[model samples]
Structure formats: C-alpha cells, structure tokens
Target: MYVAVKGGERAIENAHDWLAEERRGPADIPELSVDQIKSQMTLAVNRVMAEGSLYDPDLAALAIKQARGDLIEAIFLIRAYRTTLPRIGHSRPVETDKMACDRRISATFKDAPGGQVLGPTFDYTHRLLDFKLAADGEVPEAATAAPLQGDMPRITEFLNRDGLIQTETPSDEPPRDMTRQPMEYPAGRPLRLQALTRGDEGFVLGMAYSTQRGYGRNHPFVGELRIGKVSVEMDIPELGFAVEIGEITLTECETVNQFHGSKTQPPQFTRGYGLVFGQTERKAISMALVDRALRWEELGEDNLGAPAQDEEFVLSHADNIQATGFLEHIKLPHYVDFQSELELVRKIRSEAQANTLKEAAE
Candidate 1:
C-alpha cells in the first residue's frame, strides 16, 4: 500500500530557496562581503584553505561566505573547486629555515635564537566579552618592534650537532598523492602527514588529546613552534634555474618526544614534525603529536593499539566531508528498507502465535 513520493525536484528547489533566504537573514542588515570575511575572519579562511589542501586565500574567503560561515562546508567547496583545476608542474619544497617569522616560541628553552616572539596570539588574553567590539568592531593598533634579521636555526639542529637525536636522511622521491590514488594500508610518513594536515581540526585535536591522556603517551615537549611566510619556487626547464613563484604563510611545529634507544643503538631524543598553511598552531601541534604516535612502529616502540596509533582508522575517518555525508545520509528516505523490516517482523509474530495455539490444542 506504499506509493513512492514524487515532486522531489520541486521540493529540492524550494528547500534551496529557503536556505538562501536564511543565509541572508533580514533585509535591513548589510550582507557580509567576501572581502570583509577575508580580512576579519582570516582564521576561518585559513582553516578552509588548510583543510581544503588549497592555498588560495581569496577562494577560501568566497567559499566561507557561500557556506554561510560553516567552515566544513567552506572546506568542501574549496576541495570541490580544487579537483576541477588542471595540475601543472609541482613546486619545489619550501625552506622553513629562511622563513620570515612573525610568531615563534619554544617550551624547551627560555631563550633561543630569534628570541621567542609572541605575535597576535590569544594565549594570555582575558576571556571577558568586549562590548566595544560589538558596537564599532574597531581594534586599536598595538605597539610594534624591529623585525629580527637572518635565518633562525631550528632547535633540533643544536641537538643534531651533538648527535643527541636521530639523524633523518633526506629522500628525493616524490610523495604519493592521496587525491590522485586510493589510500592503502601501511602508508608512508609523507602520506600520513598530508592526511593529518587536511583532516578535521577537531578530530585531529581529540586524537592528539587522547595520546596525552595515556592512550598512546609520547611525552611531547614543544621544541619549537613558528609561524611565518616563505617563498615558493619552481624549477624551470627552459630557464635552467628555480625561480620564486609566490610567498605563503605557514605554521611549523617540532615536538621533542621521549628518548628511544636499544642495546644496538645510542639513546637519543625523538622528534615529530608538522607543517601546514597559515597560522594555525593548534592543528600544527596536534598534527605533530599524531605524527609521532603513528611513528611508534618505526621508532621501535610498542604499537599499544591506541586510536591515534591506528593509521587506517585515523586517516579514513578524518575527512569531515566524507564523515558528514555518510552520517547525514541516514535522514534520507528508507521506505523500502523499513517496509521489508516491517513485513519480516509481522511474519515472525504470526508464526510464533500459531505455534503457541497449536501447542495448547495438542
């Protein structure tokens, strides 16, 4: 007695219209401009670009506006748009040593080179609401200082000189692109790092927290965290030299973990690394912790079967778009499935009642 619902197209159109209206809010209020979002909501735009795996700030801003401030939706829009663009030659890896740092800090040392600059951070800010911002939305300019000169050396380099940490040999092999190919188990470190960088911020943060709470404890110390701009370069075959293409803001994190050594090897402090687009310290630190957790096998530590240690689980469920789609699909029409279940239930009850009656009569 069931009839399939019709007029799906009309329903969808109406729903979209209503959504558009909701996005605009009242007519009296000025509609938020993409430029305004790009400037004021820089963090949101940064997150979209980072998770979207695209470095375009303008597109990220547009996506943010179109998504009605939903960061995940903005990331989805950016990701979708990224797939349509043609891929040219890849750029050479950026050099963090030459970064023009705006914010830099280290927990392991009180004073380091470049001198621990704290630029535009909310770490020490009072949590009270500012009514002045609500009325005029104007922020007063803060005092400035002279910029630091020369390349700031990494804290790990100091340890490296003394042979206090494991030496990592550079590999020239190109990394596997997860977008172009299906993800496989036992993924290389580069693939895992890429997955962690683009993974849902909250999901990655939670996983990192779990490790701190004894799930896969790695005893991490923030060796250094830096935010800065670096020039991107691409090698030109015709020119016979690499040329600077553009500059991008990036956040880099290096975590010093517990020492791991055995009878065959000398004891040395371990390291975990994270690098991502824009000034996102939380994601960067979380990424580093998770990276170290995943490196347990190679570091000669026990697997411990923790969630963060499980590469497949972490990478597969990290994408909010994929997770949200599968989760939200449950709301769709499932009339056929429900009908089948209903009939099965009725048949089972009827048989049970018939058996009871036959037993009584006998």
Candidate 2:
C-alpha cells in the first residue's frame, strides 16, 4: 500500500504562494514601503547591510521588507542579489584620515585633538520602551550643525610616535577576497576582517565576551573606532586615471595590546584591527578584541589555550548564514542515514546480548 510522495511540485507552489501572501499581509492594512523600512527600521537595515557586505541602506531596507522583517533572510536576499553584480573594478585604498567622519571616539585617551564627539549615539538612553512610537507620534527635529572639524589623531598613532606599539608597514599588496576564494587555514588579517564583517553579531559578541572573562585574556584598549563613508575607486587602464565606483559606510576598530617583546626586539605593544561594512560598532569592537586575542603567539604572549586564541575556531563559526544553514539543514530528509545508524546500534546491542547469554550459560 506504500506509495512514493508525488505532491512535491504542488506543495512547493502552494508554499511559495503562501509566502508571497504573508509578505504582503492583510489587504486592508497599508503595505510597508521601502522608504518606511529604511527610515523607521534603520538598525535592521544597517545589520543587513553590514552582514550582506552591501552598502546600500535603501536596498537593505527593501530586502528587509521583501523578506518580511527577517534580518537573516534579508541578508540572504541582499547577498544573493549582490552575487550577480558584476565586478566593475577595484578602488584605491581609502585613507581613514580623509574620512568625513560622522562619529569618532578613542578609548585610550581622555581627550585628543578633535575631542570626543558624541555624534548620534544611543549609549546613554534608558532601555524603557516608548509607547508613543506605536501611534507614530511626531518628534521635534534637532537644529543642524556642521560636524566637529578638528582632526582626532588615532590613539595608536600616539603609541607609534614613541615606538611603544608595533609598527605596521603599509603594504601595496592586494588582499585576498574571501567571497571569491575559499578560506584557507591560518587566515591573514584581510581574510579575517572579511569574515568578521559578515559574521553574526551575537557570535562575535560572545567570543569577545569570553576574552574579557579571562579566556585568552589580553589587556586591550580601544585604540580607535571610527564610523564614516569611504569612497571606492578603480583605475581604468584605457582612461589612465582612477574613477569613483561607489561609497560605503564602514565602522573600523583598532585595539592596542600589551606584548612582551621577545629575543628579536625590545618590549612593545601590538595592534588588533577590525573593519566592517556599516555602522556596527559592537561587532567591530568585538572583532578587534578577538583579533588581538588571536595574535597571542605573534606578539610573544603565551597562548593559554583560549578559545579566542584559536583562529580556526573563531573564524569558522562566526557566520550566521553558515551556522543557520548547517543547523536547519538537519531537518531535511535523512531517512537513509538514520536507518543505517539504527541498524548499526541494533547489531551492536544484539551482539552484546548474545555474548552475555553465552557467558551466563557457561
């Protein structure tokens, strides 16, 4: 009486229809416009952009609305859309010094040349939920003013001035692209940053938290954290000049760590760096901490066998898309594998019982 399932095509079609209906929602209620999502649910859009490795906040917002407010699903949509985008060209390395910064802060120093500009932050806000937002209450707009103009020198630059921190030689070498290439063991900084930029916020936070709790502990100070847009340019050989391709919002973090200099050199501090796609301060900061922890050996510090110290472990598990895909895939049919396992366990138990019976009879 057993028959193979034959409704897969119909089931799939029906599922797709249901999903489309759900995304649109009740006919009476006004559909959420992309602009509303972009302006109202900005953080979700930011996260999608951050993880999707796409800089278009509007596109991310649209993706969020299209995906029915599922952030991970929105990221997947943006990534899928991005994958088809042809690589027009590469850009000149953006000089952070030239960045028109919206928000910048340094933890190592109390005051720098630019002073601490607390531009557009929710750091001190109470966690209480606002009921007025449900009714869409109007709020007064703050008076506009130009951003703080003075240059805030990097905190690490101060250490570098005194030869107290590791000196980083700026390289003209082209970094490897993670999306275009498979990740190899013992990843370089460029590759690590690529993965961290797209990494799950919660996962990176946990790894960073572990480090703070004395797991592969390194005394780290937020050497610098900057959020701004960087212009991307590519040189056209025919034109014989670099041309602007696009601009992207980025959050960059650099941390200074204590390192006991080895036989090769004098004792000095080192740097751990993090760079991400958008205004993801938490992720960028966590990434910086984890980055430093991974450099224990390079800095002549004892490994202490910390989880954060394991680069392979941290990089391999930080991505939400990868994690969710692998985890949820277990729900797919695996009857054949389950049957094999069932047979093997039964055989083992039967053998053990038989052996026990023989011993008892003897």
Candidate 3:
C-alpha cells in the first residue's frame, strides 16, 4: 500500500532557493530591472495587463520579474495582488471614439476615414532576424509622421447610418461584473465579451481558428481595429459629473459578420466587439471572432455545436488561472487512486486467466 509522505518543508524551501538562483541565472550577469522589462518587453507587459485585468504597467512589470518572465504566472501574480486592493469606486465606461489613436485600420473598407494608419506593426516587416540587435541591443528611431487630428468615425457607424447593420439599442441595465459575481449559463453579450477580454489568449485564438475552419462559420470581416490611449472617467457622486481618472492604452476590434435576417428582422450585418488593454491586435481579433460565435443564439443562427458557440465550454475553460490549477494538479500525489485501479486490474486479469484455463480443460 502506498502511503503519503510528509515533512518536506525543508526540501521545498531548498528547492525554492535553487529555483530563485536558476531564475536569476549566472551571478556574473547584471540583474534585469523591472523598468527594463516594462519598457523593452512592452508586449509582455501588455499581455499581463490584458489577462490580469489590471492596467498598472509598473506592477505588471514587477509581477513579470517576480514570475521569472513566465507571462501566465505574472498574470496570476497581478490577479492575486489586484484582489488585495480596495475598490474605492467604479469607473464610467470609456469612450473609444475619443481615443488618441496610435494605430487604426479597417479591412472591410479600402479607404477608411483615417486611411489605414499602419503605425508600429510587424505586418509589413520581413521575418529575417537582424544579428545587429543581439550585439548592440539598440533600436533605431522610427521616422515620424504628422499625427491624425480629430476623432475618426467608426466603420460600423457608416454601416449603421445606411441601416446596413443591425441597430444596437443601448440598454439602461447595469452590466454584471464577472469578477464579483459567479458566472451563470446563457450569459449576455456584455458578460461574454468581458470573459473573452480576460480569457487565455492561446485558447481564444484556437477557438477563433476553429470558427474560421467552418466549425461555426460566421463570415467575419475585420470592420475596424484601433490601438490607442483612451481617457478613463469616473462618475463622482459628490462632483455631479464624471471626472477623468486616468488614460489607458487599449486595442478595440469590431468584426462585421454575415447575418441573414430572421422572420421579423431585415437582412443586415451583425457585429462582434472586443476591447482589451494595450496593443494586442491578435488577441483582440480572436476575441471578436469568439464573441460573434457566442452570439449565435442572439442572431438567430443555427447552433452547429461548435466549441466557440458553446457558452459553458468557452467561458468555463477560458481563464488560464483556473485551467492551470486543474491541469497542474495532476502532478500531485495520486498513489491511493492508482493503487486501487492497479488492484482492480490485477483481479480482473486473474479471473480472466482462470476462466480461460477452465474452458481449455472442458
């Protein structure tokens, strides 16, 4: 019989000490600063902020350092730290139309209002590695262009004006906060989008890919994708007006999906929306796709039994923290369960042999 071993506190301590050393690497090498990670590894910090559901770059950088550059682990650290902070007040919803955009593009239209500002993207860059970066670790200054002034109109708005897209009626009902409240099945669009914004990037990407491969084909076109800094506002009860809290970089994606009209409705384009912290276009686009897929019921489309269409499946498995906990738990001791299974297998084999022998003798 296998018995559980205890008294490994000292061993665990030593193992953690060794792990710290390993994370630091050679003693001769200079330690990496949190600022360095924050500024240089901007994308990583962005991902941590997006997944962790916190926008503090400094804290995200520190979490990245503490997590030994493990993005998921850093996200976990940020989430844990966030839970400890007191909630003073809730911020009024941000207005993306007022965003100071750094990058904006639309695939649905050839000539958008902003004229497809590429801005700081790797889309046109060659995949070839530059050895100069490894030796010098210095980036050359990019050529500057005159910044686009004034608010750029949304591509969806154009469609809406023509009545070519389904009219989205604003609801006065307050959105359910997924963080505070337990998730319920048949979730509303707002709650589903919230889950996707904080969902595991890879998982969401895969689900989105599945949709593209005809799992739940909803002929999606990137209506518009904008990356920018938007002012966050808070409605102060005493002040009688919303005040600007702070600015946060966000990536917003609007996917225009095909929607043949239902019995009562006219044929018009339906939309899927995604908004996440920082410049993560891939995640934003994937989120939009998944969001549209989850809207099957609302759009009156036939549920083709796709994974992305299944609300319970996507929402339940979207969080990396919960998925990691359950997945990594397999490493823990399961000796008793294994032993019971082993004994049962042995007994079954023995019985089978005796029956085979009896049949041969007969």
Q: Which parts of model 2 have CA positions greater than 4 angstroms off?
A: 1-7, 148-152, 349-362
| Candidate No. with top lDDT | 3
Backbone N/Cα/C clashes per model: 0, 1, 0
TM-score of 3: 0.94
Model 2 lDDT at residue 95? 63
What overall lDDT goes with each candidate model? 0.89, 0.82, 0.90
Which residue pairs overlap in candidate 3's backbone?
Answer: none
> What ranges in model 3 sit over 4 Å off?
1-7, 146-149, 357-362
**What value does the lDDT take at residue 307 in candidate 2?**
91
Better of 1 and 2 by lDDT: 1
Give the candidate order by descending lDDT.
Answer: 3, 1, 2
- Expressed as tens digits, the lDDT of each residue in 121-162 for candidate 1 is 989999889999879877888896554446878977787888
Backbone clash pairs for candidate 2 read 91-233
Task: Compose the digit string of candidate 2's lDDT tens values, residues 1-362.
Answer: 22334457789899999999999999999989999998877778889998998889889999998888889989988889999999876777876665567778887887765766666778888988988888889876966456544444576788788899988876577888999999997887777878887898899999999988899867888878888777778889999998887777777889987777775657888888888776788888998888888877656567789898998999999988888889999977776787788889999999999999999999
Candidate with best TM-score: 1
Give the range of the ten consecutive residues with the poorest summed lDDT in model 3: 144-153
